[model samples]
Target: MLEPILVAARGRIIAGVLGGAAGVVVIVLLVLALTPRAGGGTVLVPDETPAPRWAPPADPPVAAVTPGPYGIAGLAEPAWVARTAKATGIPRRALAAYAGAAMTKASAMPACGLSWTTLAGIGRVESDHGRHGGSTIGADGTATPPIFGPALDGDGVARIPDSDQGAIDGDTKADRAVGPMQLIPQTWRNWHTDANADGREDPQNIDDAVMASANYLCRASTGLDTEAGWRRAITSYNDATTYIDAVARAAEGYRTAADR
Candidate 1:
């Protein structure tokens, strides 16, 4: 399973002002804490732009779609989904998965404060919302051909032996991160879910992967409504400071785009 590391370690905060970010500051970095593990999330440096402490992304709508896993896609209204997808440049199917996952998390764990924008940030960094490698997200939320990360063979990446016998990633020699969230086979096997309620839980399906991501994230951090908490949560997901910062930037960009 994806372990949540509570990083209270020491690190440098590279401050930079995002042009056209419209008053957003990122703080709470977990540098070199719990990195190089099996699964991790995947930051920037520029002239310093004076800004206040980091602000977590605004909460997304928590309107319920229905009572079952199948309803996850309907968590957001059609028109709103379309507009927000267009605004944020996120695919409609991917946006639905991310938004629905957030809404579901909001209802399931109200205090976690998991935002769809943050999920989008992850999807963007992980697999481009299941659109990476020329693969497309189907209406059912499954990524065609699926997505897999580079082999973890100790070649410029974390070396993890083949854990699933290639059952999940199709690579028996070494384990590879799979699906939109880029979860390793070991992690997926431990935390996979059936968000689509299709009777079978899959890592390739955007809905399932997103919900699994939400569950893991919420479990990693009790609350993500604050800068320090959000940073810790992202750091737990991926120990690299760059990964945390990149997710923050992507989340801020999504929120900014949605408002515009």
Candidate 2:
């Protein structure tokens, strides 16, 4: 699964993100950005246990994804972020990216059945919400110093020759996965986003990385509300049964924790 990309912020502020309320003022110029009966996911094949446990997360009323104070990151309900952050222990900043990305997708791909909790579940598994190795998610939603997976050299994982030529992964010898979503250079090229409206589609940016992950899964599977669909979509993201189940458990936990 992640062995290929299984590896996975913040930073210092990005150069373009002006200090203070200025960035909020700039967001007004930006634009907006699955599933099952099992709740929210994408793909094929039904689980032995279906529908109930994997049901789509509780439907929170999402604000319209319009120009906002923090680009798409502002779309999540402030109250929801506060309460859910306490319940799930997700950093408010990263939680916003997860929730806001789902809301942005809602208007664009309502049929996809994606949910913020599902995204959080992936975040927990991917990079502990970008907290791996003590990294932080900047206010602008970028991961500092960036994150990279172990080199894929066929030692125990798939061996992929250099693709980005040391650009994205910073490795000219092997193609290491980059970003919180752990997308390899080749995969990142296929599904990239600029949800933060920074004009750059950087995988290191959680806003971009999370949205890109949603794009990849939504495109991979028709829907993710059912066990079959969720499993399929996760499998596409990481072709391992263990990985699929891990995401399911983590996502389900977030959904349950938030609802409480």
Candidate 3:
């Protein structure tokens, strides 16, 4: 009798344990059903906004060119200048100045691989090829209204204090970038050249500015034919990555447009 009772008890215990386990499983299922799913049955994604793209300015008709002391014989306003100006939207006069400067630099340093497109790229970024603020390029490769950057009085821009004593930029309080290339007074003093052959190194003249910019870039690296050299040269001009990218894009645009 005792054995039968013990057997019955063992059966009850097993059933109880199974019942408890079933209760736990039911509770887990209920909890899972009550829990909220991620996104509420919807998928989520990160932002997919693209970076900003920079474009060259409109190709406006430039006035006729007049022979100047700085004019090079073989470099005299090529047909490609007008063609590229018309195609890439760069000013004809600006294109001529850039091309002449690049050609001059090539003659001086044949291994530099300096191209008009690169100078044009810098010009576009510096001051829209001297067309920024309604300024126009003259036959002598000078900006009509003259382009000047904001005063570098330790503001958001550089804090370079008056390096030229109000002579080049006319600001004694702080040094401001002058001309189409946006060159500081000190840089102009160091790299200034008289591409116009007028016996004076004037930053206001596009011929001089373009030549100076080209020389500076060529001196920065061995050759700009490779991306590393090109990047180094441009970074020496301006360390900002955005500025470099904008210049590269503008240069590529000019190249592609000119090819077409």
Candidate 4:
């Protein structure tokens, strides 16, 4: 009777243990079923926020200007004169010499009566004082020099001939402007002369080109002889409003620089 009772008690303990294990298993299953897993959504984190803009520094350094009479007798401030001389790449000393020569020549043609300021302005507008390197249009197509500058297509991309004969061969499509003043081939042919005494007439030469422009404007037909005539001549020289205005402004500037 005692042995049977002990065996029955051991079976009951085993059943309790099994029941507890089943409860634990069920709890674990419930947790797994209710708890969610990670999904395929993106979590974006920005690296940095933008900063507000600030004002620029005040009292910027001014450029050094050379002192001289730019093209006029002596009106330009030293700094302004220096800048113009440097811009033209014409040495201050050489520019002075040229100014002297120009004054002498200008004196003889008082009837032409244009101010140095105006002449300087014309130079500024015409070719920006030989800064522009131009190309020729030819029969094959538009021919550009390897080093033509940004002003080439001021209004539009000018088509030129690729062949050497384009300009000479009567291809209206092939002829493009040339020289410091951006003179058309026909115009250049008319005005080109040895202004610099270099034996040959070359429009690319700044001194020659500038002198030629002066001559063309001061010529009898252009009527630069009178103030009104000079105005008309300038208008014909450049048809743009801004260009005309700039020439006037530049001429004043040049005159101021030259006088000093």
Specify the highest-TM-score model's number: 1
TM-score-based ranking: 1, 2, 3, 4
Model 2 Cα lDDT, one tens digit per residue, 149-237: 76766675556778788998889998776777666777676667798887889989899989988876676665676667776666556
Report model 1's TM-score to 2 decimal places. 0.78
Each candidate structure's TM-score, on Cα atoms with residue i matched to residue i, is 0.78, 0.77, 0.72, 0.48
lDDT of 1 by residue, 114-233 (tens): 888888887776666776556788888888878776676665445678889999988999877778787777667656789987888999999998898887778667578888778767
Q: Which predicted model would earn the best lDDT?
A: 1
Please count the clashing residue pairs in each candidate, in the order shown.
1, 28, 1, 26
Every candidate's lDDT: 0.68, 0.65, 0.60, 0.36
lDDT at position 149, candidate 2: 70
Two-way TM-score contest, 1 vs 2, winner: 1
Better of 1 and 4 by TM-score: 1
By the TM-score metric, which is better: model 2 or model 3?
2
What is the RMSD, in Å, between candidate 3 and the native fold over all Cα? 28.4
